[model samples]
Target: MNVLFLGKIQYALYRLVLAETPEAYLLQTHTLPSDLNFMPTLGNGHLGYTVFGDAIFMNGVYNGAGGNSKRARIPNWLNISAVVCDRFGCATDDDELSTTNDTLYEMDLRDGYFRYRKDYKKLGITLEQRSYPHKYFNRALVYEVVASRHATTARSNAPQFLKLSQHPGIASDAFEFVVLNNGSNAKGDYRVIRGRTQVLEFERFQPQPHEIYILFSQSLEEPLQIEWPTWQMEITHRIIICIDREQSVALKDLQDALELNFQDLHQKHIKRWHDFWDNDFSIRIAGNSLELWQIANAGIFYLASSLPSLTTNQKNEPFDGLSPTGLGRGNLEADYQGHSFWDTEIWMLPVVTQFGYDYAKEVLEYRSRKLEAAKYNAYAKGYKGARYPWESAYTGTEVTNPCCPEVAQQEIHISADISFALQKFFAQSADFDWTCDKAWPIAAEVAEFLVSRAACEELKQVCHFLNVMGPDEDHANVDDNVYTNAMAKIALEFAVWAGGMCGNASTELFEKWQQVSNRLLILRDVDLDYHPQHEGYKLNTEVKQADTILLGYPLRFDKSSTHLNDLKYYANATRESGPAMTWSMFAANYLRTSEDWRADEYFERGYKSYVRPEFKVWSETPIGYEGSANFLTGIGGFLQALIFGYGGLDFYRSGNQTTMENSGVLMPPNVEEVEINYIRYGDSKCRWIYKSHSSFMDCGYRKSGKKFEMLQGNKRTLLATNFNVTHRKGDPPIYINLMN
Candidate 1:
C-alpha cells in the first residue's frame, strides 16, 4: 500500500468568489462604511428607504426651490431605534450598528432582506433582526425579529432585570410633533408617534401634500421581570411603514397589512424578486469572473428595487420614475433630488425592458403621463409639439438645478432619447397595441417638436441641431452634435413607423420624418475616418464622458467603417474623471465592431475602479472620487456592457435591416463558457452559451443575412434566438445543429 501512491494532492482549498448557492446572492460584512452611502438600501418602487441610515425618499417627492429642491427626508419612522440595558454598566444595543460581535450586516439581494445581528457575550444573549421592503408593493416596508430566552438556560441561578426601550414612531416634522400618552398597558411595548407625516419643502419648510403612516410594535410584552437574570432571553419585534398621498389611505393600507401574515407577504416579495432573476435574460457563467455575475445582479437589484412592481394590484400602480442615484440617495445635496433624467430612458431601460416589460411600459408611461408638461416646455421654449426637460421631477417640469441652467437649456436630446427608448421598447416588445395607444402619441409629439427644433434647409436634406450640448457635458453648446442628431433621426424614424402601426399619420409627415432622418448631420471627418463629437470638434479635446460613440449604440444608428475609429479616438479624448458609464459604452461599441481588438481591456475598465469592495455599490465617479453614491447611471451602463456588449444582443435594427434584433455573443479568452439569456419585453426568451472555441466566421458568411459576433467558432446551431455554436479546432469542415 505504501508503494502505490499515484498522484499528488496539494489539498489547496478553492474558494468561490461568490457562493453558487442562493446564499451567494448576499452581501455580508463586518466592515463599517466610512461613507454612509455604502450602506444597503431597500425600496418598494414608490418609496426609497435605507436599512441602517436616515435617508428616506419617495418617488417624485420633492420639496424646495432652485438648487435647494431635494428628495426631502420625511419624519424618521425609527425615531429611537432600540436600547437594551443589563446589571453591569449599560451599553447601547442597536442591531442596525454596522459592527456587532464581528457580524455587522448581511443584505440578501434575492429576497431584499437586510439582516442585523448584535451580541451580548457577557450578558449571554444575542439579538438578530432582518428586514425587507415589499418590492412589489406600492409602499410597504416590513421589519421583523423574534427573540426569547432558551429553555436550556435553566442552569442559571441568579435573575436579572432588563429594560428594552423602543421609542419607536415618527419624529422631526415640519408641522407639529405631539406625544400621545397611553396611560397604562400590560404589554411592555407601545406605539408613541402618530398623526400625518408632514415633509416640509425647502424654501419655506412647509408641509407638502403627501402624507405617510408609521407604525411600530413588538411580539413580546415589555417589562419582563426575569426569574433568573442569567436566563437566555429572546424577543420579537416588527415595524411596518406605509405611506400614501392621503392620511386615511395610508392608515387603511397599514391596517390591511396587519391583517395578513407578515411571513406570507415576505414570501410574495421573494417571489416577485424571482420573477426578475429567473427569466430576465441574465447570465450564469460556468467558469469565469464571478465579479460580473455579482455586479449584474447588484445593478439590477438596485435599479429594480427603485421601480414599482406592476405585478401587484396596488392602488398607486406606477411610480413617478427612476433617477440616477435611484432610491439609495436623497435629501442630501449628493442626490439628484429624485429627478428623472436621460438616465431613466436610456441608462436604466435595457435591463428593465429585458427583465419586466411591464416595468418598461410603466417607465414610458411616466413620460406619456407628463406629455402635457413636455408640450408646455416646447411652447415656452418657442418650439412646437413636445420637449421633455433635461431633469424632470414631480410636476414633470424642468427641475435641472438652477446652478446648471445650461443642461436644461441645451440638453434638448433628452426628448429624442425618450423617443429612441420607446422605439427600442416597441421593437423588443412587438406590442403593437402599446405602440399605437401610448408610444405613438409620444413619438408623434416628439417628431413634431424635432421637425420644428431642427434648422433644416426647406425641402432639402441638410439640418443641424445648433447650440446644443452632446453627451459630453464639458462642451455646453455645440453645433450638429453627431450623437444628438443621430438620436433625433431615430426618434423621427420611430415616429414614422409608430404612426404607421396606428394608422394615424399623413403621407407628408412620413416624408418629413424620412427627410430629417436622411438629412440630419452625422458629422464625419473622412480624413480622420471618425464621426466628430460636434461641428468644430478637435481631436483629444477633453470630453466629459461618452458622446459621439453613442451613435453605434442606443441610437442604433447604422454603423459605418468609422465606427471603430470613433470609439478608439474617443477612448483617448474622454477624461479619466468621466463617470462610470463612459467606459461601458466604449466596451460595448468595441465588441460590436468586426475588429474588436481592445474589447477585453475596455470591458474590464467598465467596472474595475468604479465598483467598491466588500459591497459592490458603485460610485458616480471612480471610488475615492467626490461624486454621488449608488450611481444607477453607471450601473445601467455596466449592465448594457454585459447584456449588449459582452452578450452581443441588439435592441435596434442596424444598417437598413428591418428587424430590431441581433445576437453576436463574445467572451474574454480567459472565460471557458458563459450562458446569456435574451429576454425582450414581449418576445420568447433566447438563451445560449459561448465557450472558447474557433471557423465561426465561415459559417456566418455562408448564412445570407446573419452576422456572427465571435472571435473564433466553427459549428453553428440555430438554438432559440441565437446561433449556438460548438467549435472544435482543426477537426471538421463545419458542424451545424438546427434545432426546430
Candidate 2:
C-alpha cells in the first residue's frame, strides 16, 4: 500500500520518479556477467540470446562492431524505463487494438503535427520533414521523402515541368526516384510540385544512440499534429521544442520535464501499485524484518517497473532489470536470458500464486494461450505432443542449442514445467473449473507429447528419450536426468487424472496417454535399495551414490523413503559441482529431511553461503549474487517443519476420512535466523512454548477414543494430554492423534 513503508530495497527501487512522470516510479535490479568476465573478447553479441528467468528476449541488434562471450559493447547511456502498471493493474484488450500481431498500433489524434528545422524556410526552401516522437513528447526525428507528383490548376501554372534541386543524399549515393510521365509521352505531363529534399542520417552513434531532439518553429501556421491511437493512459502533452540552428540538443532539461510529466502516467501506474499493496501483507519475521518484506516488494517492483512496453499495452512481460545490454538482448545472458527455463514454475510460481493470483493466472494463461504454437512446434519436430522451446519468444519457436554437435537436438523439459505450474495453480487456488475448462486439455496434450517423446523400456515401462538436458544446465544434454524423470512421471500422472475427468475426452488421446503412462520408466533399483540418478547412473566403490530430494520432498512419489539416507551424499555432490539455479531446491530438500538442530547447519551452507554477504542477493551465477526470493518457496517447508517436525502435526485425507496429528515443539523452528511460532492442529488445543524448551499440549478434544503422545527429537518435551493415551510400537515417532 504505502510505498514509503514497503522496505529499504523497495523504497530505493520504487522511489525513482520517472522523467516521463512523477507519480510513476521505476524498479531496478542487476544481472551478473558470465564467468566473472574473465575474457576480454566477450561482447554484447550473444547477450540478447541469453534467457533470464521469465523475461522475454528480443534479439539484440548488431552494433556494427562485433562482440564475444564476456563483454557487452553497447552504448554508454543510463538505462531508463518508466513504470507501466502494477500488481492489480493490467493492459486489457481495450488498452490496445486487437490484432493477430502484437506490434503497437498508433491512431493519430486530431492535434497531429510535424516538425523540421526552422532556418530551412529562409533559404527559399524547406530542407526536410520531421515528426514528433508522440503527441505527448515533442521529440523529433527526420524522415526522407521519396517520389512526389502533383497536378495544379492551369491558372497557377507555376511549375508544369518542375525542376528538383538540393536533394540530400546518403553518405555515398544520391536519392533514386521513379519519374512519372503522361499516358502518351506528349499527351499531358504532370510536373513535380514543391519538390523538397529530406534525408535521414542513421550513422552509428553509441553515445547518443537514441538522443531525442524536440524543436518548434516560432512562426508556424498550425500546431504540429501528432497522436497515438493505441495508448489509453493519459500523458502530459506540453513540451519544450527548440527551434535554434544548433546541431545537438541537451537532454538535461528535457529529462526533468519527462520526470515531471511522469504523473500523467501515474493514474494507470498507481492503480497497479495499490493492487499489489492490497495483497496479504507479509508479517515481520524477527530483527529488521523489513528486509523480508523488501524481498517480496522488490520482486513485485521488478515485475511492475521493468517492463517497458514497446507497444501501447503489453501484459506479463519480463523486466530486463539493470543489464547493460538493454531490453532487446535475447533471454538474459549469464542467466540464459533468451531461454525459458523451469525456474518460472518451481521458484516464481508460488510467490505469484500466494500474492498475485491474477498475475499467476496470466502466467498459466500464457501457456494455455500458446498451446497452438507449442502444438505446431511438436508437429514440426515430428512429435504428437506440444514441445516447448527451451528458450522461446512471441513465436513459440524453440531456441535451445545443445552443446554437443554430433547428437540430434531437442528442448525436452518444458512440458514438465508447464504441467507443474498447472498443478500448482490447482493446488493453491479454488479453480477446479480452470482444470476442466483449460488446464486439462493442455495437460492431456502435453501427456500426449510426452508419450510420443518416450521409448518403451519394458512392459508397462517407458523411458524418456535420452540426450536431453535436465534442470541443471551445467551437466547438459545428459540422459534421464533424475529431476527430469521425476517431473515426467508426475506430469503423466496428472495428465491421467485430468483425462479421466474429461467429460468428452478424445478416445485417441486417452489411449495415447494410457500407453505412455504404462511404459514410463523410473530409475530405481529394488535389489540395491537405491534410486539411481539416471538410467545408467552407476556408482563405483570409490564413487558414492547421491540422494535426489526431488522425488520425496516435492513430488512425494516415494512415501517409504521418509528419511532419505543419501542426502549428505547429494549435498557433497552439489557443493563440488559449484552453484546452480537448482541448488536451492536441493538445499531446501535437505532442510526438509534434517531434524531440528541439523537444519540450521545445512540451511546456512546452502542458502546463506551462496548469498551475497553484503546485500544478501542471490545471483544466478557465482560471479555475483542478486537477492531473489523466488527460492523462498521453500519457506512453506519451514512452516511444515514446525507443524510436522516439532509440532508433530500431520493431516491426510482419504475417501471420506480426515486425519490430524501433532506434538508440541515448545521451541520454534528457525529458518535462516527467522523464528517460526510452532503451532499444531489436533485435539482442538493449541500447543506453544514461551521461552523454555519444555512443551505441553493441552488436549482440547473430548472424544473418548482420541489419544495423545509426546514426540521427543534431539530434545525431550512434555505433551500435556487430557485425552486417553494410546501407545503403539514400530512407529518411528510419537504423535498426538485426533479421531472423530
The model with the greatest TM-score is: 1
Clashes of each: 16, 53
Compare the candidates by lDDT and give the number of the best one: 1
Query: In order, what is each prediction's RMSD in angstroms?
Result: 8.6, 18.6
Tens digits of per-residue lDDT for model 1, 401-449: 8789888899999999999888777666656678788988889999999
Candidate 1 positional error at 186, Å = 7.8
Candidate 1: regions farther than 4 A off:
1-23, 66-68, 87-101, 136-138, 148-208, 215-233, 260-265, 279-282, 458-461, 653-660, 668-670, 676-678, 694-740
Q: How far in Å is the alpha carbon of 221 misplaced in model 2?
A: 26
Q: Model 2: per-residue lDDT, tens digit, 1-740?
A: 55435443442343353223211122122323243221011111111211112121222221112111111122111111111122333222244321112221111111111211111111111121222222122121112111111122121221111111122112211112222221221533121111111222112212222111223211112222223122211111232322111213323323333354323332233333344343321222333334343332333332222222222221212321222222323222443332334445554554444443444665566577667767877887788878765544333444333343222244376687688678656643424567778888788778878887776667435566677755444344557766666677778777877666656556776666666665566666676665656656553222211225566545555634433544544554553324433344444444445343454444333333433322223433333444222222233322333233333333432222233333223223332222212222332333332222323333344234434434434433343445333323223444432322
| Residue 252, candidate 1: C-alpha displacement in angstroms | 3.8
